[model samples]
Target: MEHRQLVHFLAVLDSGSLTAAAQRVGLTQQALSKSLSRLENELGGKLFERGTRGMTATRLGESISEYARDIIASAGKLRHTASAALGLERGRLVVGLSPISAASLLGKRLTQFAQNYPNVRIDVEGGIDRDFVAALHRGELDIALSSQVGGQYDGILLEQVFSEPWGVGGCVNNQALQDAQSISDLADGKWIIGRNTDLLDDIIAETFSNAGLPMPKPGIMTTSVLFSLHALSQSDFLAILPQSLCRDFNGILWRDLSDGAWISPIYMMRRRRAHMDELVSVLLRELKG
Candidate 1:
C-alpha cells in the first residue's frame, strides 16, 4: 500500500530472492518480508510464489507490476527534474535495444556517454522489438532502439536513426553460392532462416516480392542468431539478415540482393508527451551522430 512496500515488492521481483532483494533495497530480510506481508494483506492476495530458484510473481503481482514500474518511473522523473533544476547532474536512465541492434550499436557512444555523465546510471535491456516496446510503454525504459514496421504504436514517437538493408548472407568459403547476387540468384541455394517474427518474415517476403522471385522455403529454422550464423558458415544455406550483424564474423559474407529498396528501418523511440531529459538528449545526440 505504501510507496516503500511497492518498492520492496519490485526489488524482490527483480532480484528474485529475499536476501538479494534486501541487499538491493538496503533492508534486512525480515524487514523486507514484513513489508511484503503487509502489502499482500492490503491487496488481499499473495504477490509472489517463492521457490528455491527464485520468486515468481503470481497473477495479481504480474498485473500490479506494470503500475508499480510506472509509479517508480514518475517518481524518478520528478527527482531528475528537481536535480536538473538544481544543477546536480544525476539521474538513472534505462534503455531498451532489440536483439539485432543491441550489439551493433552502443559501442563507442555508450562509453562516451558514461564518461560525460559520470553521475547518471545507465541500464540496458535487450530483446525483440515487441518486448522492447511493451517495456517502454510500462515506463521501464526511457529510450528504445528497434526495427519497427511503419506506424504501429500510437503511444510512442519514433525517429529513424539507421536503416538495415536485408541481405542474403552466406559463408565466404561457400563455393556453392558463389554466383548468388539476388533473391533469384539464391533460388537453388539452401536457406537457413531464424526466428519467424512477424516483421522479419514480412521483410523476407517483401524482399522476394520486390525481386520478382518466390520466397525460398527455409531448410532449417531456429531462434538463435549465433547458431544461424554458424550454420551459414558450415553449410550453403543463405540467411536474410542485416549487414551490420556480419561485421565482426570474419568468415561470413553478406551479399546485397541488389534490391536496395528493402531496408528495415531502425527507430529510436520514446514515450509521447514526455519532456526530453538532458541526459536523454545527450545520448540521442550521440546516437544521431
Candidate 2:
C-alpha cells in the first residue's frame, strides 16, 4: 500500500532473501517482515513464498510486478520533475552502453554531456544486449545504447541510431582468408564471438545452414569486445564484427559473407512512457548529433 513497501518488495525480489534485502534496504529483518506482512494484507493476497533457498514470487506477485515497477518509476519521475521545475540544473541519470558502442566514443560523449550539464550526475555501465534491457526494465537504467531489442522489453521504446553490415574478420595472415570467398570457404576455420543468446546463436546457425554449411562452433566465447578482437588478431578465430572496424584497425581482415546475411544495429532505448529527465535528454541529444 505504501511506496516504502513496494521498495522493500522489489529489494527482496531482487536480492532473493529477506536477510540480504533487509541489509540492502537499511532495515532489520523484523521490520522488513512487518512491511511485507502489511503489504500482503492490504492486497489480500500472498505475495511471496518463503523457503530456505529464498523468496519466490507467487502468481499474484508475478502479475503485479510490472505495475509495481511502473509505480516506482513514476514516483521517481515526479521527484525529478519537481526538482527540474525548481531549476532544471540538477538530476541523476544512469546510462547503459553496449560494449562496442561504449569503447567507440564514450569518453568524448560523456565529457561533452558533463560540460553541458555540470550539475547532473551520470553513471555509465557497459553490458550485453539482454543485461542492458533487463536494467532498463528494473528502472536501474534511464537510457541504453544497445543492439536492436525485441518484445521482451514490453515497456521500452527503441530508436535505431547506427547500422552497419557485420562481416567475418580474422588476422590478415590467417590461411583461411587466403582461400575464403564465401561462408563455405571458412567452414573449417575456428570462430570467436561475443556471448550468444539463443536468438543470436540461432540466427548464426540458420545462416550457415542456409548456405549448406555446418554451423561453425566458436573456439572462444567472450563478452568483451576487446578480447574477441584480440582473439581474431592473435589467433585464427574468424570473428563477427562491425565492418567499419576493418577500415579502422590494422592487421585485421574482414570479408563480407556471400549472402550478406548479417547487419549490426545499435539502438537508443528508453522507458516508453516515462518523462525524460533533462540530463538524459541532454545526453540523448548529444548522441543523436
Candidate 3:
C-alpha cells in the first residue's frame, strides 16, 4: 500500500530471495517480511509464494509487477525533474541494446555515461529488438537501441538512428567459396543461423524467395553470435552477420549478395511520455554526439 512496501516487494521479486532483497533495499529480513505482509493484506492476496529455494511470484504478482514499476518510475521521474531544474542529477537508467549495438561501440559509451553521472545508477541489458521493446513497456528499460521490428507498440515510439547492412559471411581461408558473390552462389553451402530472429528470418526468406531459391535449412541453429563465428571457423558454414562485426573479426570474410543487402535499421525505442526524463535526454545527447 505504501511506496516503501512496493519497493521492497520489487526488490524481493527481482532478487528472488528474502536475504538478498533485504540487503539490496537496506532493510532487515524481518522488516522486509512485515512490509510484504502488510502489502498483501491491503491487496487481499498473496503476492509471492515462498519456498525453501527462493520466492516465486503468483499470477497476481506477475500481472501487477509492471504497474508497480511504472508507479515507482513515475515517482522517481518527479524527483529527477526537480533535481535537474536546480542543475543537479539523480535517478537510475536502464538501457537495452540490440545484438549489433552490443557488438559495437555502444557499450563503451555506456561506461562513459555511468562514469560521468556518478549520482545515477545505470544497468545495461542485451537482447533482440522485440524483447527490448517489451522491457520498455514494462518500465524495465528507460531507453533501448535496437533493430526495427514490426508490431503494435501501442505506447511505444521508435526513432530511427542508423542502419546496419548484413552480409553472408564465411571463413576467410575458405578457398572454395572465394569466388561466390551472391546468395545463389552459395546454394549448396551449409548455414549457421541464429534462432529467435523473427524479423531477420522474414528478410532472409524473402531475399532467397526473390532469387527463385527456396529457403535453405540451417545446418546448425543457435542463439549466439560467438557460436556462429566459431562454427564458421570449424566448418564450411556461412552466416549472415552485421557488416561491422564481420569487418573487424579476423578469420571472417563477407561478400555482398546480388539480391540485396539486408538492412537492419536501428531505432531508439522508448515508452511514450508527456516529457522525457533529464537522464534520458543527457544519454541521448551523448549517443548522438
For all candidates in order, the CA lDDT equals 0.75, 0.74, 0.76
Candidate 2 residue-wise lDDT, 1-289, digit = tens: 7988988888787677899789766799999999999999999999999987899999988888889888888776776686467454777777887655664454357668878878777778866565665556656678888763543566778887765567788898998786687787887888776653344557667888877998777687776766777667887778877665564677788888746667666778887876776656667778777
Candidate 1 lDDT over 86-195, as tens digits, reads 44267777788776666555444666687887887888776656555555654567888877444567677888887676677889987655666556766677888775
Q: TM-scores of all models?
A: 0.73, 0.67, 0.71
lDDT for position 206 in model 3: 84
Pairwise lDDT winner, candidates 2 and 3: 3
Which predicted model would earn the best lDDT?
3
What's the best-to-worst order under TM-score?
1, 3, 2
Report the Cα lDDT for candidate 1. Answer: 0.75
Model 3 agreement with the true structure over 121-141: per-residue lDDT tens digits = 787887666666545654567
Worst 10 residues of 2 by lDDT: 99-108
Estimate the TM-score for candidate 1: 0.73
Between candidates 1 and 3, the lDDT winner: 3
Pairs with backbone N, CA or C atoms under 3 Å apart (clashes), candidate 2: none
